[model samples]
Target: MYIRSAAAVSPQASFEALFTGAAGYQGEQLSCIEPDYTSYIDPKLIRRMSRIIKMGTAAAVESLKAAGLEQPEAIITGTAYGCLADTDAFLSRLVEFKEELLSPTAFIQSTHNTVAGQIALLLKCHRHNNTFVHKGFSFESALLEARTMMGENEITTALVGGVDEIIPASHALLRRFGLYRANGDSLRLVNEPAKGTMAGEGAAFFVVDTQQSANSLARLDALQTWYKPSTPNRVADGINALLAEQGIEWKDIDLIVAGRNGDTGDDALYDLFKKDIPETSFKQYCGEYPTATAFGLWLASHILHEQRVPGVEGLKPRRILLYNHYQQTHHAAYLLSAC
Candidate 1:
């Protein structure tokens, strides 16, 4: 399948801005640099949608517009934490009001599949719509389903994405579990390894189809995911098998985009996996989250389309390999090539 158009509401100001330099974070969180909703959404509707919904809807609209399609045959989304702000609000109201005199708006939009449903509603696209929430494998699962539907001729085009966000309450709770450091730097996230990684969140969307369009970004050659591998060698074996199945040799991969989250133990596995494969990481730019690989995929697609690495100069790649895992589990690999 080919990724025809890709859009993101991430920490960086824009896609080109990321190549210039990553935005820095002072503490243990990297919040999104949100765009003006008046341009993408109706001002009245914007007042009702939560942060996650706004971000997801904006990316979906931009992706469809860029793909030159008013509507898609399918809308699929994956989110590890869905409508977290709404959920937090609903619970807080429930506690404060003692289960009385509470509005249903927050409760209505607190579902895990709310983003997919909202997009479908906004586009009047009453087609196949689904959402996956499988912890770290959320985004990979959504991509796999889209690929299967396209391969089976079930759908010609699909709108797919992964969205997640962090709130103050959730951030505090997660920090209590030692998920983030007390103080950190996003610019030096990968360069300076530590015991914990910063909390990051964003939304990324793509228009994918079997047919190549004029605006096609890159061809998604293959995708694979593994869960709970017994050892690191198993991960390597999986990578080798995927390459062999596609008749692609290791040398054919011009660049490897790895998911090194800046934790000493988490990054050690990446160091062992990529042995002199000219690998680079995206966590330093996007921070560490379950669906952060969606950001990585977006970056790789642009690299192949533009034929230039963000910070690296004068090196063009025809084929790119993207590998990411969440907490040493839920491993995934994707092979992308220039279209």
Candidate 2:
């Protein structure tokens, strides 16, 4: 499939800003630099939507506009933690009110599929709408389903996205479990390895079609995912198998965008696999999240489309490989070509 267009609501202001020099943070979490919603969403409705919903909707709208599409044939979303703020509010109200005469707004939008459903409602689309909530593999599962539907001739175009948010309650609970570093630096996350990585959250969406178009950003050649393997060598074997199937070797790949989240234990695999390859870490720009691979894919697509690497001047690549693993469990690789 070809990526017609891509958009993201992330911590960085823009793609150029992210590549040139991202803004540094001193806190343990990175929040998205949201865009103005007046253009994408109704002024009156914006107040009702949560942060995650607004982010996801705006991104999806921007992506569709870039693709010159008004309505997609399918809508799919992947989220690890969906509408966390709303969920927290609903649960708190349930306890405070003794489960009597509680407002249903928060409860209504607290489901894992709320973002996707909201998008569909906004567009008046009744096509195949689905959301996957498989922790780290959520985004991959959504993409895989889109690819399958396209292959089966069920849809010509689709809007697929991965979204997650960071709330105070979720952050505090996760910090208690030693997930984030206190007052960690986000800019130098990958270079200066440490015990924990900073928290991150964002929403990224893509418009994909089976046939290439004038606005095609890149050709998605291959995608593969692996679960917890018995040994590290199995990962290497899987990489080889994927490359062999694509009829390309490691030397043929011009660039590699890896997931190195500054955590020593988490970044070890990325370090071992990226040896001698023209590689760069993306987590430094976006911090660490469950579906971070979505941001990595977004970066890769833009790099191929622009024919330029952000910081690496005078070096252009034709093919890019994206490799990321969520907590060393859900591993995924994507091969993209500048076609």
Candidate 3:
């Protein structure tokens, strides 16, 4: 499959800003620097939309516009925590109001599918809409499904995305659980000798098709995900299997973009798999989120399209490998080639 166009809204403002060093990592929890919603959505509709909804819809719209498509034939999204702000609000209301006279808006928008459904409603698209919420593998699952649907001729073109939001309550909870680093330089997260990493939230969308286009950014050569590999050798075997299936070797991979979130345990797994290959990390820029690999995918696609590699030491890349794992169980790899 080919990515016709891509767009993302994150704490770094925009992907271009992120690559150009205009955006800097802030702290432990990075929130998206949202775009002007009025430009992409009507003022009236924007009032009722939650942050996640607005982020998802704006990204989808921008991607479609860049691809010159009025609407996609299919819409797919992956979200680890969907509409969390609204979910929190609804729960708070349920408790405060004792389940009486509760407003339905928050409840209606709290579901995992709400983002996907809202995008479809905005585009008036009625075909092949879905959302995945499988924890860290959520985005990978969505991409895998979209690729399969395209290969099966279920749809010629699709809009795919991953979105998540961080609320104060949830952030506090995660901090208590030692999932977020309390203090550290987010840019040097990989070097931090700490037990936790920063948290972040963002939305990224891509317009993809089975056929290549004049505006194609990159080609999706292959994607594979594994669960609980059990050992570093098992992870290595998975990587080798994917390379074999794609008819490429480690030498063919010009760069390896890894998901190192500064967590000692999780980064150790990547350390075992990377093994002397030219490598870099994206979590330092995007922070740690379940579907943050979507941001890694966006970064990989941009590097291939622009033919430039930033923040990494070594040769310029032509073929890039994106590897991400969450909780040391869900591991995913995607191969992208310059188009």
For lDDT, the strongest prediction is 1
**Candidate 1: which stretches are off by over 4 Å?**
none
What are the models' TM-scores? 0.98, 0.98, 0.96
256-339 in candidate 1: lDDT tens per residue?
999988898888888766556677789878888899999999999998898888777787888999999898888999999998
lDDT of each: 0.90, 0.89, 0.87
**Candidate 1 local lDDT, residue 288:** 87
Estimate candidate 1's alpha-carbon lDDT, on a 0 to 1 scale: 0.90
In TM-score terms, candidate 2 sits at 0.98
What residue pairs clash in candidate 1, if any at all? none
Question: Among all windows of ten consecutive residues in candidate 3, which has the lowest summed lDDT?
Answer: 18-27
Model 1 residue 85 CA deviation in Å: 0.6
Q: Which lDDT tens digits does candidate 2 get at residues 213-298?
A: 99899999999998997876688789889999999998999998988899999888876676577887788778789888888888
Off by over 4 Å in 2: none
